[model samples]
Target: MKPLKRILRILKTISLYALLLIYLSPFFFVLINSFKSRREIISNPFGLPDVWSLDNFVTAFQKMDFVSAFVNSLVITFFSVIGIAVFSSMTAYIFVRTDWRFNKVMFFVMVAAMLIPFQAIMIPLVQIYGGLNLLNSRWILIYMYLGFGSSFAVFLYHGFIKAIPLELEEAAMIDGCSRIQVFFRIVFPLLKPTTLTLIILNVLWIWNDFLLPSLVLISSSNRTLPLTTFYFHGTYTSDYGLLMAALMLTILPVIIFYAFLQKYIIKGVMEGAVKA
Candidate 1:
């Protein structure tokens, strides 16, 4: 019986590893194939490269102008993230702490706005962007991101805020802190985990977004990293190697960032959800 149980445990472990490999094999394939030359990729699709080369990386950079596009994406994502976190945090605090006649009405309105589809408003948004003379600028996209990011961020913050006892702020106020200082100094620090979650979530969404940026940013140089696939697809029509290399480069930064920060993201999400 002991021998049989030990064998079963080993088999279960093997099966778990097999499932993990099955899920991750696609990424492993891309990472390996991105280094292979065009001919080698076509001739031996799943095998190791005949000779390792950086030619595809060079071509992808030159063809897609990867560096400039990445810079545009980073800048747009940064501002959008900051604006969303600050606006949403302040707004959520107002909703939670204030005693206004319209408090409940405003919260319901935010919930309703979350239900509205972006497609329904795209035309109006485009016209507004055009009117602002922001059709080819990153700022338009940043603002749009703020609008979309707000609904979710507010909900998360609102939930997390409920778990915070009001007496903490009352005690701070008793100690001579002003309303703004009580919030910025005391209540705000307690909400750090939720804010961190919002930052990560908004940054990921704004960074990987392609459709909105495509519509708002028409110029090649102003294009976001994901949108750079426009010319990459058109120009490298027959070269799968170059296409895959570009794809890999675009995904690497996201993967690296998530690898280090994912612990905090998960912790924040769990704390906010469970405590709310």
Candidate 2:
């Protein structure tokens, strides 16, 4: 029995390692090709670079207008995430604390909305906003993100908020705090873990989103990193080395952000699950 268990454990470890390698292979391919020349990338993509160079990165940065794109991405993601977190948390709090039939119905509607895919509404949504001349603006993009992102955020916050004791809010109100004060001071602070989880999740989604931005933002000056990366592809040809480098630059910030806050994701989910 001991011998059999040891063999099984070894097989499991090997399987896990193999899966990790499979997931990381694409990223490694991009990283390797990012350092090579265009000709080398085209001729021998799998081979190591003859001479590691920063030229592709420099050219990609210049051509993509990296700084402007980065700032646009940052602003859209920041505002969208903030709006989602704030509005969703407040909505969840109202649903949890109040016994209103309207609140219950609205909550159910929002949850049902999540079941509808963005692809289903994509064309109509774009056309409606475009007809209004509301397209191609960062503020409009952020507003749309908030509308789309809130449902899931509210769902997460709803479960977590239910786990918080109503007694805490009652105590604050009894001690001369207004309803607003009670929530801001007592309930909101306790929502830290859940809020952090939502922020990171929404940041990753909004930052990497391409299709929505492409439909909404028509101007080059307002493009995000994902949109800017499209510059590497032309009608008849593409710059593979520059494209890889651009991809690396576009993904690096979110990768770093995720790496640092990854632990909180599980922590928040676990806490909400256990408490809910």
Candidate 3:
């Protein structure tokens, strides 16, 4: 029995490591190739760089106008995440705390909206906003992100808020705190873990999103990192080393953001699950 258990444990460890390698393989491929020359990358993509150089990164950074694109991404993601977290948490609180039929109906509708694919409404949404001359603006893009992201954010917040004791809010209200005050002071602070989780999730989504930004932000100056990276590919040819470097630059920020806050995501989800 002991030998069988030990064998199973060893097998499980090996399988887990295999899965980890599988997931990380593409990133490793890109990282290694980014340091190689274009010719080297084309000839031996699977091999390590014979002479690792920062030339690709330097050229890619300048060509992509990486600073401008990075600023655009940062502004859009920061505002979008803030709007989603604030509105969704408050909206979820209303739905969870109140017995209003309208709130219940709205919550149901929002959840139903989550099932509808964005691709289904993508064209019409763009056409309408474009006709109104609302496209190409960061604020407009943030508004659209809010609309699209709210349902999932609300759903998560709804479950988490439900787990919170009603008495806490009631006690605050009785102690001279207004409804708004109670929420901001008591409820919102407690929602930090879930909010951080949502922030990280939305940051990754809004940061990497190319299609929506491509459709909306028509100007080169307004483009995000992912959209700027598209310039690396031409009609007949592409710079693989530079492209790989640009890709790495695009993903590096979010990777660092995720690494710092990743523990909270699990903590938030587990707490919400248990509470719900």
Candidate 4:
């Protein structure tokens, strides 16, 4: 029995490492190829660069309009994430604390909204917002993100909020704190872990989102990193080195962000699951 268990454990470890390598293979390919020349990439895509160079990075940066696109992505992601966190937490708090029928119905409807894919409503969304000339505005895109992202944010917050005790809020109220004061001081601080997780999740989503921004941000100046990369690749036409470099640049910020917040994300998930 011991021998069998030891063999099984070894097999499981090997399987996990193999899967990890498979998942990371594409990124490794892209990183290596980014340093190669266009001809080298085409000839031997998987091999090491004959000479490592920043040539691709320089070209990709210029071609992709890195500064403008990065600023646009940052702005959109910042406002969208802040809005989602604030509104979702408040909405979730209301749903958890209130026993009203309306709150229950609304929460149910929002949860149902999660099952509806963005692709299903995007056409009508474009038409309606375009008719109002709301298309092509970054702020409008942020507002749309707020609406779309809120349901899941609310769902997560609702579960986490339920775990919090009402006695805490009651104590604050007894000490001359109004409802708003109690929420801001007593409850909101306790939501930090979950909020951090939500911020990371929504920031990643908004930063990487291509479709919605493509539809809304018509002007070149207002384009996000992903959109800029699309146009940059089109203009360069089969410059795989530049393409890979641009891709790496686009994903770098989010990777750094995740590295910092990954532990909080895991903690939030565990706490929420245990509470539920």
Candidate 5:
């Protein structure tokens, strides 16, 4: 029996490692190939570069206009995230705290919106925003992100806020604290883990989003990293080496951001699960 149990455990461990390697293989391939020349990449996709040259990175950087695209992406993501966090939290708090038929209907409507695919509404979205002269604007893009992101953010905050005791807010209110103060000072502070989780998730979504940005941003100057990297793929040919390098550069920040906030994701989930 002991031998059988040990054998099962060893097999399970091996299976887990195999799955991990399979999932990580593409990233490994991309990273190694990013250092190679175009010819070397085509010939030896899995092997190391003959010389660890920065030429691909240099070409990709200039071709993509990395600095400008990076700033554009940063600004759009930062503002969109901030707007989603603040507005969603406040809206969810209202829905949870208030007793009104209209509020309940609105909350349900927002939740229903999540089920509707973006492709269904994108044409109408473009038409409406275009009529309003809102296209090709980064601020408008941020606004669109906030609108799309709010439903899920509100859902998360709604459940988490329900788990919070009302007595805390009531006590604060009794001690001369205004409703707004009670929220910002007491309620919002307790939502730190969930907030961090949402922010990280939103950051990743907004940073990598390609289709939405492409539709909204018509000018080359407003291109994000994903859009910028896409320039390497032309009609007849593609720059594989530079494309790989651009992909690495584009995803590196998101990887670092997730690494920092990953702890909060598990912590938030466990807390919410226990409390709920």
Candidate 6:
């Protein structure tokens, strides 16, 4: 019996490591290949670089216009997160606190909107933005993000708000505070966990988005990180070395940020999950 148990444990450990390597193989390939020269990469990508070169990363920075793209991504992501958090929180609070007929209907409509696919609406979105003269502007992306993101954000907030105590707000009302004052001063502060979750999710979406930004951004100068990487794939061919280096640079920040803040983000999600 003891020998059988030990054999099972050993097999489980081996299986776990196998799965880990399978998931991480792409990163390993990218890291190893990034060090190789374009010719060496093409010849034997699986092998180590004969001579390590910073040239791929150095060249990518210049050709990819990394600085401008980074700035554009930062600006778009920052505003998008803020807009999603504030608007969704406010909307959620109103709907959750009231029993109004219209508010209930509106909540269902918002949830239904989440079922609509982005591809189905992309043509109409482009047309609307064109008519509104919002083409080629970063704000257009932010606006679209807020509209698309609010449904989920509000959904999260609504559940978390129910779990929060209503007595605190009632006490503030008795102290002559209006509903607005009670919300910001009393209830909003209690929603910190949910807000953090919303911020993290919205940031991730806005930061890594490629399709909409590529379509809307008119110039290479206005490109985000993902859009900037497109130049790596030329019509005739591609520079795989520089492309991998740029890919590393683009993802490093997001990985680092999530690693540090993921604890709070996880707690927020768990705490805010609506129990049916």
Q: Among these predicted structures, which one has the highest lDDT?
A: 4
lDDT string for model 2 (91-128, tens) is: 89999899999999999999999899999989999989
lDDT per residue as tens, model 4, 82-120: 999998999999899999999999999999998999999
Candidate 4: what lDDT? 0.89
TM-score of predicted structure 4: 0.88
lDDT of 4 at 164: 97
lDDT value for model 3? 0.87
Q: Residue 157 CA error for candidate 4 (Å)?
A: 2.1
How high is the lDDT of residue 259 in model 6?
92
Model 1 per-residue lDDT tens digits across residues 149-235: 888788888888878899989998999999888888987788887888777667767888877887898888899888897668887
lDDT of each: 0.84, 0.86, 0.87, 0.89, 0.87, 0.83
- The collision pairs in model 6 are none
| Segments in model 5 whose C-alpha atoms lie over 4 Å from true places | 266-276
Q: The CA-based lDDT of model 6 is what?
A: 0.83
- lDDT by residue for model 3 (130-191), tens: 99999988889999999999999999999889899989899899999998899999999999
Error of 2 at 168 (Å): 2.0
The count of backbone overlaps in candidate 2 is: 0
Q: RMSD, each candidate, Å?
A: 2.2, 2.7, 2.8, 2.6, 2.6, 2.3
Give one digit per residue, the lDDT tens place, for model 6 in 86-183.
88988999999999999999999998887888898889989988888888988888888888899988888888898887888888899999998888
Q: Please tell me which predicted candidate would have the highest TM-score against the true structure.
A: 6
Candidate 5 lDDT tens digits, 1-276: 699999999999999999999999999888988888889988889888889988888988887789999999999999999899998999999899998999999999999988988899899999999998889999899999999999989988999898999998999899999988988999898988788778867776898898899899989899888887776555214668888888888878878866887787666566645543
TM-score of each: 0.90, 0.88, 0.86, 0.88, 0.89, 0.91
- State in Å the error of residue 64, model 1: 1.3
> Model 2: residues >4 Å from true position, as ranges?
1-8, 265-276
